[model samples]
Target: MKKLSNTVLATACCYSSLVAAQTTNLNEILVTASRTAQSVDETLASVTLITRKDIERSQAITVADILQKTPGVMITNRGGIGKSSSIFLRGTSSKNSLIVIDGIRVGSATLGQVSVEELNLSQIERIEIVRGPRSSLYGSDAAGGVIQIFTRRGAGRLTPSFTISAGSDGTSLAEVGLQGGDQNRWFNVTASGITTDGFDAKTTGNIDDDGYHNQGLHLRLGQRFDGGHELEGFFSITDSESEYDDFSSDRSDTLTKVMGASGTFAVSDMWLVNVSAGRSWNKTKAFSGSAFKSRHETVRDSFTIQNDLLISDDNQLIFGLDYINDQIDTNNAYVVTDRNNWAGFAQYQLTLGKSDLQFSARVDDNEQFGSYTTGGIAWGIPLNNNLKLVTSYGTAFKAPSFNDLYYPSDAYGGGNADLVPEESDTFELSLRGKYQDVNWQASLYQTTFKDMIAWAPSPTVLYPYRWLPSNINSARIRGLELSADYQWQQWLLSGNLSFLDPEVRSGANKGNRLARRADRILNLNLDRNFGALTLGATLHAEGRRYTSDSNTSSLEGFGTVDLRATYQLAPAWQVRAKLSNLLDKQYQTISGYNQAGSTALFTLAYQPQ
Candidate 1:
């Protein structure tokens, strides 16, 4: 099956190659790839930008819905809205990739995973995904890549917007916001709420309606002074409650909050300096019936100081310092609850004779894990006016999460303090280009990991057969990615394909496929615009997957389709509708979990012109 899918994708790529409908311009100013702004086509990396227009066009309720399959990304959900979800970027573990929001890292300290499901699209302005090792630019948890989310910002004259919607499964949504900006200052404030009586999440053993509710706010203000100086500040929060089936509890309540401020100053014509600080909080409380079960909370404080300098007409340099502190507050006592990490990084960019080159390095020192260094190099050569060739190599590592090192001993298992961090090396090459209205890319890459952490039995006096986390695995992964975007007349065609081979290199399960990593993923989007009305469709397919290292249990391959439409009533009013899972497919990406059957939603909006 995998071979057949690969062959089909290869044939499609040779037919013209692709990325997406809105990406052919090559004019996007990307900031996540190199920690500095550059045109998307000029960066020597695999990157995707999802704009506000794209978000509204998709009519997606959750953030993960917008990132299902874009090159090297794969998403799995335990169930529906507000359920636990995982994003396997580059076929790496959930904890291997990093998630950033408005310059602040937000996630559970214990699990080291981001809750992408809880992130709705109403307050989001855009999303940027960089697929490759980014530890050289950001300190930790960037072995696979980095995903950055930017919230709504003010621009132009004062404007007000609101949206109300209803959907299947008793789902509902409401949002309101006011935004405005001039040359000197800007401000934006938004509030949103959503609720859904979801479907049963477990295939068997437990039959119940799992429901979820969430409310959130986003507030931002920014000021620009003379001499190319600026300052910005933002605050955002989400509170949610969800129901699911579990042995210890059946309900989960969570609160996620973030606040931050940043400033940019130009000291000289050739140099610029920036400063920023932020705090994020994540807390989860479990409940069954009316009885409270447990609680886990995480707080993160971060600060940064960076300087950008233009050495000459063809050369630029960037250097920065970062400070991060993670502290935990939980019901269960552990050995240690807090840790700090200090990092310094430098990057150099050169544009010489139509060729681009970038070099980056970073050093991080953690309170518990001592120090580590990583580096990367990238080059882009223009083969002609219509094509370009790019190559890159990088190294990255992931530190153990709090649960892996400090969880107290229990009856079945416990944490291990004497564990080493996992390390990885990646090499990539690609051919990318644009021709008039068509943009396409074909990329191939491989990554090798050492000292990967895993759970295994370790005999001891107190707990003879306790399973504890240890650095006991290694893996080798190879992948191919094909993406393309084309716009012709009134129709837009865009899509991407992901092929992954994540293998366990050294373990009792050696030669087995990496647990839960699917080998083939295909996504496509087709849209047509007719006057004031627009119509579109999305198709997503994935290959089979295993549930554990032993590969005994497996889940079959599946596919889904979504249909959407939008009609413009006026310049300031519009209506939208989406029929999700249009095929009414019954499939599960996660073992033993049940997926939502079908859902439909209709929305009306009052947006500013």
Candidate 2:
């Protein structure tokens, strides 16, 4: 059957190539990384793109799964889908990475990081990742990298989709979605539910009988006036109940909801205004016989206004201001805290000689941490028609979280109000060249951090015997990345390689590598297009890494391969089959957890005209 299918697909491709011509201009892409609509190649940064086809082939369920495919990114997963997870970029600590949703920062103010597991992949249109510091464009917590997620926007008329799947771990999931409404007004809505008896807990030596269940609903609505003005609103609500294997692994049932609205208006031919506002609420409750307990309520609200002005034929200026208010009510051993923040930022772009230069600056004021300023500069110079050299330098800062400032401690918890914010300076340079049918890019960067905060054992006369948040004098990180893509008449080959070195330069951690950071990572992708059928394969390699701050525990890295193929069953429907971890390599990416091996996934997609 396989040989027959291959021959048929090849024959169809030959026929199509003889009758149709393909154009490269039709492949142009638009992105919002610089807060503007620009072609992908025009952006002067180290960017990685994950397309819808990639997502379908991977069969990912959450944002983390997709992010892990990008070069220079490492993800730590505690268990199955929807479990606790954190992301690291170029050997930077997990908290150093920032997550943005629809251009807004959504990371928890107290945890110092957001749960990427909380984001569903079903509604995402695309994900754009900019590696390295971007504090010049975004503010604090942009040290490691910037991840932006773009949700589905209605295209034409009302369209809907549904999917159901059951997997190895006794996992079952169902999802339904609807989108579209003409060209001027449209809306997209998605709802999903999942339940699992769960795979066995390797540690406890038996199947996790407790299992878990989760349900979520999401909606996005947009309207455009006849005159070219637009308004958009989005909301997401989720609830979950799950069980833990033991006291150490226990977790609380959670309920989370978020609602937001944004709009854009064309004030004149050369000026445009954009505004946005939103709110979020999170609640968690612990079950009986649980060692970890918390009944916390968090509410976040913010607003932003931006104005774009055309200074001249070669100059453009964008000025913006924003305000945020956060409130937390918790009855845990970790203390309660409240914080309000306000910020204003401005960015300017100019065409200078044979180069394009971008300047940006911002200042943020926190009620508890006072105020700080951030700034950055980006320069891009064309070496020729097919090559460009880009470089950028910026400063970023991260304020202390509620848990960092005020947690209670008998043995396992505590707080430090006197804690200061962390700051870092970053510099990066890169070259991108596109010639004929081949395109390639390479980049190098370094970052230096001051007043790095970490939980350290009390020295001499501290009250807590175990740990306390203290400032480390300095930390240093450096990395190099190379990516290339070659396209032939019927075959495409792409690969990326990254190397990172992160170390503690001062304090008790001097010479120790940062925790959960992989020193090297590599990925390669191959695709062969045969008319309405395409065959693809991917290989990933990860290097050994440490799992603890003390560097006492380690995990040996491993390699995995994935194979997939898509067949156009009909004009409107396509079927795909994928085999993940093709070699069935059994290895632990994390210290105490085992990754799934040799799994198969199949998907069917339909498009109606």
lDDT of 1 by residue, 1-609 (tens): 001112222222211111233544575666788876665777888998988888889998989888884778888898888899999998987788888887777788887778888876788887889999999999789989999888888877999999999999999999999999886788889999999999998886578889999999999888877776778899999999999986567998999999999887777667777788999899999998889988999998999998877676568788999999999999998788999999999999887778888899999998888899999999999999889999999999899988888887776677888888899999999999887888999999998999887665566897675778878568888999999999898899999998899888886889998878888999999999998999999999998888776788888889999999999999999999999998899999887788888789999999986
lDDT of each: 0.85, 0.71
Query: TM-scores of the models, in the given order?
Result: 0.94, 0.89
In candidate 2, where is summed lDDT lowest over 10 consecutive residues?
Answer: 12-21
- The local distance difference test score of model 2 is 0.71
RMSD of each: 7.0, 8.0
Q: Choose the strongest candidate by TM-score.
A: 1
User: How many clashes (backbone atoms < 3 Å, residues ≥3 apart in a chain or on different chains) does model 1 have?
Assistant: 8
Alpha carbon lDDT at 551, candidate 1: 86
What's the distance in Å from true for residue 12, model 2? 41
Q: Lowest-scoring 10 consecutive residues by lDDT in candidate 1?
A: 1-10
